[model samples]
Target: MSALAYSQLPNHLQPLLAKFYRAHNSRNRIRSEAICWVARRGDIVGGLCLTPVAQGHFLTGLLVTPPERNRGIGAQLVRNAVASSAGPVWLFCKPELVEFYSRLGFSVANCLPATLADRLTRYRSSKTLIALQNDQRMMPMPNATLNIAIACLLDDCGRILVVRKRGTRFFMLPGGKAELGETPLQTLRRELREELDLQLEDDDLDPLGHFQAQAANEPDHQVEADVFIARLPRAVTVQAELEEMAWLEAAPCERDDIAPLLRGHVMPALLARMAQAERVACCAATSDQGEIGSLAGKVSSIASSS
Candidate 1:
């Protein structure tokens, strides 16, 4: 399967998309002005439409064919939209779906456009729905905002690999500033090879998101980072501009040497992800236990009857 984004609604895909939504029993339709992100496997299997608005971008129609559900097509569409969009992306969904979208980094919106706020109030009065927003933190750029791509290389024990550049006091994630004509993945790959003697393909990385935090080495500066997670194939040595390398605990206790970006923003996000994982695991275990008990009871009943 492949995905694509179209700035304008294509003339040929109009009817097909309309039919796609109808098959899913949705009445919402896409407008020509909205940006289109589509997932295709021989045909369109999933799609999400982004409509420009004063606040940011309002998502209009989102659908995935029944046969294509649980294949991560919807996630790809939403991730592409948020990463490529200039600002936040907003949507309304039923309460049951809140958990699904929340796993993709969406949260209940604290604020919204006056018109949308009003619309949500009226809609919620009649249905069980809530508003969500995915903020890219691009509304206003900070002073000396450096855009960098960084890696979150975790070890078998769940420790993160950190590096200190030559003559720098701060220890940061393994990455550097984006050079001319380079994407985030390109920057991460180049930086890792140069700094840590590590090699990786784009598919090896799981993009966390673009994040903003205080700059590590510079005073009164900020950094916008494209963060990713991947495994370390083997132990690494300091190389290139790196002077030292270290491993930080999943929740690091020492922060005097850690970079502000890692200590402040990245750590919190990581911890949140870990906590969510625990909750999911616990739920799955309980479900499995219940199923096991049911099977045992059935077996005992059959033995007694026989």
Candidate 2:
């Protein structure tokens, strides 16, 4: 990725980038004052721009050309831009993209400068946006550490479905360790069917990346889990080794019954995603609107659930 002030960018490249931003209906949000970080891989792949904010810098104009997505171009651009800053870097993106940004070590913004928070409030009305700040923690764990596959099922009401095995004390995500010759995804599919009585196809799940934490049930060992996200389509009944199943609140809570991986990494990430949604919903709740009231109610119901 090449980082240069918009003014210092070569003359010919200026129009090209302007064309790019305009294509996304966001023009000179890359003005001469902003620093544009462009990345090319055998072709002009994509670019992201950063500008100064009082607390730190805010990232904007992250445009990855349509044809080049899933190739990690946008991720690379984001990584480079974030590393360039010595202070907190913030950005707002659609809710669906939370996992992608979370893998890059960004969680929801805990606090924000008045200007960006107001901008986000305005953006939240028309677009379901979530504000995130770089936590800068995207280091990969060894895959050989533990061959485990896990699934996170988030319901429409925004709660995560968790299960407690027949003899287990902790409530954890529904999944299990991999068997020999099975890939993590395959392990996940089989485990889900066995424990939750829920059968899912490969397309039903989206990879959230891998995580490592001390095993909750297995002592003296750690688990390297390949985490995936899926929508909870229907009600699940406990089966096979599962003794009970329940919905876990997405909001942060001080519960001691959570498994290690769920407590350490996954919960924190989910909480970050919830942070923006809470503000969006609660902001509307404090005012008076039924639509927003529904969301606020959901949040309230979740926090109060047994």
Candidate 3:
């Protein structure tokens, strides 16, 4: 596949691009200054348009033919647009597609540029536009920080419960930011109740360790975590504040969305504790067997002597 500049595209491919944009119901007119990137696999397989908006560029009309979907053509098109653009890139997509864009390194913004915001509002009202099915907005890309408490709730099967917040792709521990006057443990308990609907007392939680890592949602910001190990019940009804939940093994996970602190610090600590507990249990069992053997020999000798 190759990325072609708009002027580089053959005249024969121009019609195909127009058809692709129409199919997606894109209203953004291709202006003289706008940058369009087309992905071709002998024919036009996918494409994206970046139009200048305020201080950044708005990514629009991104589409991959159904036959070419999941083949990485869409991702390549996005990469091309981002690589060619000199400013921050922004886009409005359905709430469901937030994770998709997030994996491509686009952070969701709590605020948006005025022009893009107006366009998004209008796009939502248009029934012809399928991509803007939800009212979720995208913001200009910037770095920010998040303060939160995290928990490593391990089940009997040695799986840790990880949670992904709404509108986010990465899955971290089931905890939130520390509220004023609330200790880390208190934050953990409150978050558990609010996020997982699981209640716990101080006795149920054990301090694993304090950790720090990059925040998943905010770029260039760090997350300071007070990590703890909580014993989860056999079954849990996760609250709706989370997008999804998973019971992942305490090992090197291949998932990209796993939080940095959980992957680097929390999991390893939990694994070490589990190993230590196993060793202690094995030693205790061996000692008990040795005691039993010694008592058996003494009883046998006493019987023989009598």
The list of candidate 2 runs beyond 4 A from truth reads 1-145, 274-306
Deviation in angstroms for 174 in model 2? 0.3
Worst 10 residues of 2 by lDDT: 1-10
TM-score on alpha carbons, each prediction: 0.56, 0.45, 0.52
Query: How far off is residue 49 in model 1, in Å?
Result: 17
The digit string of per-residue lDDT tens for model 1 on 89-202 reads 889999898976775668899989887888889988889888999886833332676889999899999898988999999888999899998888899999999888789999
> What are the clash counts of all predictions, listed in order?
0, 0, 0
Error of 3 at 304 (Å): 1.6
- The candidate scoring highest on lDDT is 1
Candidate numbers sorted by lDDT from highest down: 1, 2, 3
Query: For model 3, how does the per-residue alpha-carbon lDDT over 149-253 read when each residue is reduced to its tens digit?
Result: 777888888788888888888888899898887877788899888887788898888877656567877778767676778789757766767888888987776
lDDT at position 98, candidate 3 = 74
Model 3 poorest 10 in a row by lDDT: 128-137
| lDDT digits (tens) for residues 1-306 of candidate 2 | 232111223545666777767776765466665667786654455777778887578888877777555445576678788877777889998889898788676888889889998999998888789999874443344123455888889989878988898887988889998999787778999999888778899899976655667777766666767778889899888889889888887766568888888877777766765686689899877776777879998999999994
